[model samples]
Target: MSRTAWRWSRRPSAPSSPRSRPFRSKPGTWRRCSGANAVMSCRSPAGRRRHRPPEEATMQPEPITCRLIVEAVAEFYGLSIVDLLSHRRPQRVTRARQVAMWAAKRLTTRSLTDIGRFVGGRDHATVSHAVRVVDELRERDADFRQQTDDVVLAVEATARTLARFHANGPEDVDPVAVARRILATPRGVPIVSIPEITALASAVSAQELTDSSKMMTGPMKRFRSEPRDRESEFDLYRAVAEVLEADRALKQAQWTHGERGAQARLDRGLKALRETFERETEHVD
Candidate 1:
C-alpha cells in the first residue's frame, strides 16, 4: 500500500461532537458532566462540589472619640482635663486646648460644634478657630508640629488598644479581679529607663488606671438593667477606657525599659486618669 493510503487508513474515526469530547483537567482532579450538554462541574476527591471558602472576617479599629483625642492631647501636653475645659487663657493651657480641639476634629466624625462640646463646651466657631490655628502652627512651627504628631500617635495607639479590648474582651470580665491584678502588678526592679516613658509613667499611676477600669467594668450589669443617662454612661466609659489605655502604655514601657521608665509613665498616666475620673464624676453628677 502507498504511504498516503496507509496514513488515511490510520485515521479511522471522525471528530466527536463538543459535548461528547473528553474533558481535560490537571492530575488528581476531574470534571463531571452534570447534563447532556457536558458543562464542566468541578468536584473534590470526595465527589462533593468544590467551593471557595469564605474570606476570614477582619477586626476593624474602633472609631477614635473626641473625648479620647482630648484626653490623649492633655496627657501629652502634661495638662489636666480641667485645664483644657477651663476658660483659662494661659498660653500653655490655650495651646494644649486648641491642639486637642484640632485633634478631635481630625480624628473623630464629630461636627465642629460637637468637638467644641467635647473639648470645653465652646461653639463651632471656637473649634474652627482652633483647627485653623493648629494648621497654621503646623506649617510654621516645627516644634509644635512634632508635638502634634506625637499627640496624634498617642491618640491612635490608645484607640487601637480600646478597639482590641472591645473586639476580644472577655464577656465575664470581673472588674474587682482585674483591678486587684492591676494593683498587684509589680513595678519591677529598677533599671535603665527612657525619659519619655518615665515622663508618661510619672504623669499617670496604676491605682488610677485600675480605679477607672473598675468603674467602667463594674457597671456592665447595671447598664443592662437600669435606664441610666446614655451621655453620662458614654462619658464614663471613655474615661475608664482612657485610664485602661494609659495603664497598658505603662506596661509596655516597663517591658521595654524596666522599672524606672515605667514609673515615670505611670506617674504621667495617673495624672491624666485622675483628671478623667474627676471630669466623668462631674458629668455623672
Candidate 2:
C-alpha cells in the first residue's frame, strides 16, 4: 500500500521454493565424498563389479631341484629316500638309486660330484658310473626306458604342483611340517648320530667355543707332522672348531640382538656345512 511496501513486494517475491533437504544417494546406492569440494562417487551394490588382477597364466614353473628329483624317483620305485642313498646293493635299491642320480643329472644344474655327494657320501666317479649305467640300460631295454619315463613324468608333475602351490600364496604351508615329512628318518638310522654330535658340541667349553685358535693348536700340530695321513683328522678337527666358532657367534648375536640377529650367523654355518670340505693349506708343514 505505501511506497516502501510496494518496492519490497515488486522485487521478485523471494523465489518461491520448498524447504531444503540433506543430500542423499539413490536407494541401494553407496556414496563416498572426498576432497575439499566434496566430490562424490556412487555405486549400487547389485550392479557393482569387483576389480582383480589378471591371472598369470604365462608364469614360468619353478625350477626342478635335485632334492625334488631324488624324492620323486625314490617314491616312484617304492623305496625310501634313505634306502636310495644307502650303500645297499640289492637289485631294486641299486636300480632306484641309479635312476635317481640320472634324473638329478638331467633335471638340475648340479655337478656330477654334487649329485654324488647329495645322493650319498659318494664321489664323482660313482655318480659318473651310475649315470652311464642308467643310460645304457635305458637305451637297450624298452621296459627300463618306460620305467624311467614314468619316474620323470612323476617328477615333472610334482614340480608343477609345487609351482602352483607357491604361486597361489603358500602362506598356509608349514615349512617345519614339510621338512619333517621329507626328512622322515627311521628310528635307529644314522640320524641318531645327530644327538651324539649335539652332545659333543655341548661338551665343548666356553673358552674353546670362543677362541677357536686355541682348539686348532693340536690339529695343526698333527697336520704339520703328517700332512698326508693325518689330513682327514685335522680337517675334522677344523670343522669342529668352525662349528664351535659359529656357535659362539650365534650365542653372542642372540645375547646382543636376539634371534633375528643370530639368524644370519646360523645361515652362515649352514652354508659352510653345505660346502665341500677343503683345507686352507695343502700341507701345514
Error of 1 at 108 (Å): 1.0
| Each model's backbone clash number | 20, 0
Off by over 4 Å in 1: 1-57, 167-285
Candidate 2: clashing pairs of residues: none
> Model 2: per-residue lDDT, tens digit, 219-242?
456545654656666566556566
Most accurate candidate by lDDT: 1
Clashes of 2: 0
